[model samples]
Target chain A: MTTPEPDRLFTPPPLMTSPALTPPGLTPPPPTPPNGVPLPYQAAPPPTTGPSRAPVVALSALAAVFALVAGLFTALYLGERTDRDTIASTRADQERTLANVTGRQEQADATLETNRSRESTLTTQHDLLTQCVEAAKGYFALPPGQTPESSRLFRVMYDVCPQI
Target chain B: MTDHVLSIPSPPAPPRPRSRVAVVLLSLLVVLLLGASVLTIVLFVGAKEEHGLEVQRLDRTSRSLTDAEGRLAETEQTNDTVTDRIATLEAANAELHKCADPAKESIIAARSDDEEALRPAVRRAAENC
Candidate 1:
């Protein structure tokens, strides 16, 4: 298997400093590169066909990240600010509405007090009327010949106040 | 065309594998950015939640205010009814005064076998005996 068959040969690519094309005693291969790695090209420079990069791409990605984060933070900030403002506005509205309610409550309290006072006065009047009715009954209860002073007293009691 | 013979030599071993620190850094940074993005999304959602709670609170307050308004109207109606009752009582009190007036009693007494004109309550309480 060391030698190829006569039909076909598959040629392999060469290493960077290989000497297959060079004569055996022509000279030692050129000195190795100072870094011990071989030069990428024996003539001219590396092919311009593969990926090429600078740190700018990473920086650009980082800048894009910053922009995205900043945009998001700004959006959140504005949204929260708007919500807080709405809450403040709503609270003001509630306060105003509550003030009206408080005013109505005050009016209701006044009306209630007036009603209570009226009820108290009515109770007093009712008591007086009851006393008048009792006095009228007593006046009518005077016997067949009551004293003149008693008659005058009975008349005064029943005449001045009426209760029904 | 010329027939040029080509000699093949062994290919060099693949270049030594390089450090992947830059890829790792970019991956870690992307992960960090994704995390920040998630947190930003949460903050946005939290804002909506706060507003939602505000809306619910306002709705509750509105309901409470409606209830209070209804109660106030009921109280006002009650006041009107009581006021009307008081007015009726005042009118009744005025009418009772005419019956109970003692100055007219003398005229009624002088009349003969009198009291057909008197209300039942006055006749019942009259001292004819």
Candidate 2:
């Protein structure tokens, strides 16, 4: 009949045991407060398995950039190699053409020399023939019925064409 | 502890990573490329020098050929001149031969006087013997 003891305060459910948000089979780890004491009013900390390695990820990204640069350089080097090969072959071709031109020039020189010698021979023959004709003229002009005074005409004729 | 807890909310970003091996390799590659470029430059210079030398040789050859051609032309001209002279002389010689051969009447006339005087004497001498 008298007033009962003040009703006990309504108790709130613990955060770790709340099934409305937490995944199944996963339990929250014990809380580690700054003072190393568990507080009754706060939720527990989430579990952490091992140390993080963010530096290694950053280093891997840097390495990938370096590799990209090196690959570009290699491509440039290959292009240079092809250019060098093309230049070398062109130089060889030019040298071959020069050699051929020189050879032809030498042949032309030889032909020119032969022609000169032939011309000299013809000049000599012409001179001898002229002398023969002059001597024959002189012989014919002698007094009528007189024999030639000397063998000069005969000598000139024979010298004109030794075979003749 | 208070300072560390306060520092956790805004920690400095991690320092940029540097690859020492890659830097060294890049330096070496640059040096190698520079050396190769120098060598190529020297080769190009040498090739240019060779080209200049070949050009000089060709120029000399051209001059020589020109001179030879001139001489050949001169010789041909001389040969032609001589040939023409020879033909004219031969024609003159043929005319001289035509003139030198006397007519048969002239030859007979030259010897007929002596032969006529001897014919009457020979008959008079034979009758006495």
- What are the fnat scores of the candidates, in the order listed? 0.07, 0.00
Candidate 2 chain A — worst ten consecutive residues by lDDT sum? A1-10
TM-score of chain A of each: 0.57, 0.50
- TM-scores for chain B, in order? 0.51, 0.65
lDDT, candidate 1, A5-51, per-residue tens? 44655443356346776678774365343333443434433434323
Report the C-alpha displacement of residue B35, candidate 2, in angstroms.
Answer: 1.3
- In Å, residue A20's CA in model 2 sits off its true spot by 26
TM-score of each: 0.47, 0.38
After TM-score superposition, the amount by which residue A7's alpha carbon in candidate 2 deviates from its true location, in angstroms, is 21
Off by over 4 Å in 1: A1-44, A48-54, A126-164, B1-71, B101-129
Total backbone collisions, model 1: 0
What iRMS does model 2 reach?
11.8
- Residue A6 of model 1, lDDT score: 41
